[model samples]
Target: MSYRSGFITIAGRPNVGKSTLLNALMGQKIAITSPKPQTTRSRITGIINDEAYQMIFVDTPGMHEGKHLLGKTIDKLAVNSIQGVDVVLFVTDRHLGKSETKILNYFKAISTPVILVINKIDLLKSKIQTDEIILSYINAYPFKEVVPISAASVTNLDHLKEAIYKYLPEGPQYYPEEMVTDQTDNTLMAEIIREKILYHAQEEVPHSVAVVIESITPNEEYNTVDVTAIIIVERSTQKQILIGSKGEKIKKIGTAARRDINKTLDTKIHLSLWIKVKKDWRNNPNELKRYGYQDE
Candidate 1:
């Protein structure tokens, strides 16, 4: 029997459920999700392996105009991820807004097969509206396939996978079956911590916050790991807000992050979180590089 394997790049504007679709397809939570936009900051690869095929999915940061050095780097990552892929999953909601149109225009020029995945159908009121939305996209481009799915509820995702497989060529698996993601444990830890901050922090704090794992020490005798991370902010006022009165806010973020890390590590994790002011780190190229925003 012939085997099939390829890379599928998930592209969309910010907060359009790209991360949610990646997690749902993987059947596990490798990429972190929050209600905030630009929650994903890097090019993370999730592998789906089975008896007949291996589908490598690249979950990229949302495509949006860059507001700072970090934002520009993220936008570059998303654009770069679209290149040299076997298939591109252009994910969007029912609204064909300007950003979505821009993305569609960009994808139209790419040589790889582009599948229009209209996500969030679960939010639609009726099938007639879904059909109308599908028709609008159908007229926009000659897509290999147009699939409507609800990435949130995992509805119709199987059909989407089938649509992707239709374009995949027979090839060897790029990754081993045991490996599910390309991110290191340290990077994953930092992202998990950042996810907690995005979930708990208020206003602009989520965009300015960057968690750096300074150390991950293992205690062999106690079967526990000590994780020391520093959360970088732009100003002292932001630091004070993150720390909260009596350090309550930071404590809450740490507690939630620690729980999630413990589950991932399957061992007792001692998470030590600290706050620092970086004075517009997002705009500083050096600071963005230090925070692991450099392209790879």
Candidate 2:
């Protein structure tokens, strides 16, 4: 196939720094990152513009073994995004152990060409160790390419990009050349808020929380974005934790989130944060559909 534009999905276990890697490739932070596992609850698509090619990268939630309503839904979304893509980049950390084996078992037989991306090489401390880890991945799967890099430091990513071009199917551009992402402005606002909350809270609270942008009003002085986002949770206790005593914790979250919103929207934002008991929204099929977690 001639050089063409297409989608490339990034798949890997949680906390493997997949989101961090996507931001490096795009040279901007489009997806939210957190230290907590399963920080990414939905599929995020970013557009890469270059003179020779236009590649759309899809950052997916980490893969895990579970049957819970939310886990099943998240895994399904990650798996579904890989279908019909030009290439699949499967990332894994050098510290990764058995979990890596489990994730590969699912994709080893898939038709899409899999690129084994060994990330976090900066922690390897030696070139010989990195080489050994690379060989291990090669022996495990019939990968299209074996590339090592550190997403945090943006190392060796050019080789990974070059590997992707070799397998991309020839076709027309899927997005405008000047475009960077397909995410809506409103969605971007919500994600920015969510990113702040995640960075501040980390694993102290679950990362399953979702952010919704209720309203935005543009004015000469400043734009007041009235956001009534529900911090969805599986239980009442989690709701209490998010709300905090006299709402002090959430107040901090709101303050931090507002700062990011103001920068993204180019104006002051009045963000109203609220917590609601969704009763396991992740597992509830009806609730999931309503929250835009339905099958795509």
Best-matching candidate per lDDT: 1
- Taken over the whole model, the C-alpha lDDT of each candidate is 0.90, 0.79
Cα RMSD to the true fold for all candidates: 1.2, 2.3
In the range 83-137, model 1's lDDT, one tens digit per residue, is: 8999999888866778888888777678999998888999999988888888887
lDDT of 2 by residue, 104-184 (tens): 787765789999898999989898998888877777778888889999999999989999998887788778777888777
**Model 2 clash pairs?**
69-283
Minimal lDDT window, size 10, model 2? 217-226
Candidate 1 residue-wise lDDT at 74: 94
Instruction: Look at candidate 1 and tell me the lDDT of residue 112.
Output: 96
Instruction: Return the TM-score for each candidate structure.
Output: 0.97, 0.90
The lDDT of model 2 is 0.79
